[model samples]
Target: MTLLGPAEIRELAASLGVRPTKQLGQNFVHDPNTVRRIVRAAELTGDDVALEVGPGLGSLTLGLLEEAAKVCAVEIDPVLAKALPDTVRRFAPEHAGKLHVIEGDALRVDVDEQPTALVANLPYNVAVPVVLHLLATLPSLRKGLVMVQKEVADRLVAGPGSRVYGVPSVKLAWYATSKLAGKVPPSVFWPVPNVDSGLVAFTRREPPQEDRNEPSQEDRKATFAVVDAAFAQRRKTLRAALAGWAGGPDVAERILRAADVDPGARGEQLTVRDFTRIASQRQSQAPHG
Candidate 1:
């Protein structure tokens, strides 16, 4: 398949009257090497059905079509969405049948068929939420690679106790294991972003299992609530930070103690499992029976 270069990209954009918009975070990738690297890092197999978000100008989409059995691209912009199919037909006619385009918001798009892998140059502004949402919505996504802003990449792959560890890190850990695969220079994009981009590669894993009792959906909700509340006041210790979430400071202390976590510890120090334990304690202490 022919990949889009600087000339072809510019020509297509000019034809469609498309200019990269800051609001959409549209920095189109024009480097052939960058697109090839992203596709290789994704590790797509012949059986894989890939879901690509914000496929601006079909650069990555063309690369994905080369590897994946089917490429379902979700684009928010109507012009690019309409132009993508014809571009594919012109550039990679043999693979045209493998391409499916969905014109809508990635966050709200309903994917009827579960994609075996995800590959995208995600919009920098909404990268974290979009990744988290797709992982939660599609159970069959076993693995994938995404190119995002460098700082966001660090946060997504950050582990407990790391300086950047917080909400994105913990929540992402609840679904998949992630690592920084590589970095892309700013020169690769059409409207070069000020900051570099990093590739975050991830493999989905089962949620932590309960040894004796099964954790329910309510347990997940309660744990996420604790996570949000704890980070909402990052400066405060767990006992004080979770006061409103756990009903009060005293009750929060008891819950922390029951979970065998130190009440003085801050939210950044706790893992998703620790938060789950705190949630379990809260549920147990509730007036029931």
Candidate 2:
């Protein structure tokens, strides 16, 4: 399959009257080598159906098409979405039938075919939210490789106690295990971005819930609430930060003690499992309505 290079990318964009927009975080990859590297990191199988979000200009989409059995691309820009199939037919006529384009927001878009993997160069602004949303909504996604802003990539792969570890880190931990696969220079993009990008590879796993209990959606909601509250004021101790969430400082301390956590500890020091325990403790002590 012929991948898009710098010249071809510019020519195509000019033809479509598409200038990269800051609002949509559109920095289209123009390097075929980078596309191949991302595809390789995805570790897709012949049976895998890859779900790609924000497949701008069909660069990475073409790469995914070459690997996965089928590639379902979700592009918010209707023009790009509509043009992707034709681009595939032009460059990879043999694999044109394997491409499916959905013109809608990745956060809310639904697909009929269950996708086994997610591979995309995600929009930087909504990268974290989009990944979390897809993981929550699509239980069929078993693994993924995504290109995101370097800082965002660090947060996604961070573990508990790391300085960058916070909401994104803990939230993603609830769904899958992630690590930094590689980095891409800005020179590879059409309208070269100011900062470099990083590749994050992830594999889905069971939520860090007690093995005896099946993972509960309600538990996830409750645990995430605790996580938000704890990190709402990073400098504050858990007792002080969680006061509003637990109804009061004393109540928050009691819940923390019950969960075997130190109330004086800060949010950054705790893992998702720790937050889960605190949520469970609070739920157990609450008055049953």
Candidate 3:
């Protein structure tokens, strides 16, 4: 299979009248070695059906096709989505039948085929929201390796108490364990991005909760509300930060105490489990209708 190199990438884009747009976060990967490295890091099995988002110019898509049993690519751009099948046919004719292109926003697209893994060169602007939305909606996604902005990567994998840790870290922790896989240089892209990129690798796990019971959608929604509230004002203690969410400062303190959390603690100091516990306490204390 012929992977797209720098010249081929520019040539193809020019032929298609496609200019990489910052609005779409369209810095297309042009290095064949980088593509191979990303695919290798993903560790997909032959049985795995991969879900790729923002597959601009079919660079990483071709690499994913090499390993994954099936690839469902969601492209927001109509032109790119329509052209990907042809690109695959020309570059990897044998694997053309394995490619499925869905034309829609990754955040809102409902994929028909059950994809076991997510592997993509995500647009930097919507990377976090896209990842969170997919993980929430696609329960079949057991693992993933995504390339995103370096700063966003750190936030995704950051631990509690880490300076970068906040909503992304706690929310992602509810779904899976993530780590920084590797860093990519800016020179690997067609319209080289100013900032470096980083690979984030994650594997799905059960949501954090005290009991063995399966977490309901309501439970997750409730926990996330608490997470949002806690980090809304990072400098404030839980008692003050969560006051709006819990109704009042006194009520917020009561809920925190009930959850066995310190009211004086800041949101950055707590884990996903702590947040879940606080959500549960708030629910228990609320008057049932």
Candidate maximizing lDDT:
3
lDDT of 1 by residue, 1-289 (tens): 7999999999999999999999999999999989999999999999999999999999999999999999999999999999999999999999999999999999998987689999999999999999999987788889989999999999999988899999999888888898999999999999989999999999998776444656556766677888999999899999999888877888889989999999999999998899988888888785322
- How many collisions per candidate? 0, 0, 0
- For model 3, the superposed segments whose C-alpha errors exceed 4 Å read 287-289
Q: Give the TM-score ranking, best first.
A: 3, 2, 1
Error of 2 at 151 (Å): 0.4
User: Weakest 10 consecutive residues, lDDT, candidate 3?
Assistant: 280-289
Question: Model 2: clashing residue pairs?
Answer: none
Residue pairs with backbone atoms closer than 3 Å in model 1 (clashes): none
Write one digit per residue (lDDT tens) for candidate 3, span 58-82: 9999999999999999999999999
What ranges in model 1 sit over 4 Å off?
A: 211-215, 287-289
* Overall local distance difference test of candidate 3: 0.95
Residue by residue across 1-289, what tens digits does model 2's lDDT show?
7999998898888888999999999999999999999999999999999999999899999998988999999999988888888889988999999998899999888877799999999989999999999999999999999999999999999988899999999999999999999999999997889999999999999998754888789999999999999989999999999999998889999999999999999999998999999999889895332
